[model samples]
Structure formats: C-alpha cells, structure tokens
Target: MSRERFVVHLPVLATDLAAAKRFFFCDRLLDGRRRCPLPADHVGECGPSRHR
Candidate 1:
C-alpha cells in the first residue's frame, strides 16, 4: 500500500549492449547485484546520462 521510486540505467549501442544498471528490490531476485560490465571502449569517467 506504499509506493517507492527506483532508478535503472542501461547502456544501449547500435552495435551492441554496452552496460546495464539494476535495482535490487528483494533478496530472492536472481542476479540482484548484477551489473553490466563496461566494454573496453566505454568510458566510466563521465557521470550519468546528463553528462553525456
């Protein structure tokens, strides 16, 4: 009976999937802490989508 906001980010490329961001809702979820690994060409120094 309550609402919670969650944010998820995923990197999408025309050639391939670059990265993925996840939100862990429950302990029973599969790959709850899984994160999309960044590709060699991808840059992590940039912040969120706002920066790019």
Candidate 2:
C-alpha cells in the first residue's frame, strides 16, 4: 500500500519542536494572496506585525 506524504515549507529542529509548536501566527488571507503578519491572538484590526 502507498502512504500519502506531505511537505513542510518551514521545518523546525527536533530540539526546538516543543517551542515551535507553541508559536502562533495570524493566517488570515488577504488580497493578492497575502496573509496577515500578526500574532494569531492579536486584537483590533489585522495589520502588519512590524513597522519600518
């Protein structure tokens, strides 16, 4: 039998797996195929997580 496989674009190290699992980021889809760059539990309007 064949098993389905999946690929992870961003891979975390085994040692950091625990921390990585706890990390959260906003995944709201935006126009032009962009995603929100804020924390997953952010409040107010969704916007960039940084300012330059």
Candidate 3:
C-alpha cells in the first residue's frame, strides 16, 4: 500500500472540533443523537457556528 497526499477542508463544519468530530462520527445518544455544532458536554447546549 502507498500513501497519497490529499487536502480536504471540513466544509462549513462546526466551530467546535470535538462536537464536529462527534457529529461526523455519528455517535449515538439519548432521544436519537448527541448534541453537536458545539463542544457541549450537555445534551441541549448546541452552541458554536459551523461557518465560524
């Protein structure tokens, strides 16, 4: 196997990296899925701006 260099930006993703990771990772949570778009430890505080 060989490694190739490829650059790709997370288009309009959450400003919060941790949240974005969770979202993109598709982590399951209560009621459906975990809160995201923000690095929130809670379930309702979906803060941060993706465009930011």
Best by TM-score: 2
Best by lDDT: 2
Point out where model 3 deviates above 4 Å: 1-12, 26-52
Tens-place lDDT digits, model 3, residues 7-42: 565676677887665556222343433334443454
What local lDDT score does residue 33 receive in model 2, on the 0 to 100 scale?
A: 56
Tens digits of per-residue lDDT for model 1 on 1-52? 9668686666454433423222211222224454333333344432222222
lDDT of each: 0.36, 0.68, 0.48
Reference-based TM-score, model 2: 0.48
- lDDT ranking of the models: 2, 3, 1
Candidate 1 segments whose C-alpha is farther than 4 A from its true place: 15-52
Worst 10 residues of 2 by lDDT: 13-22
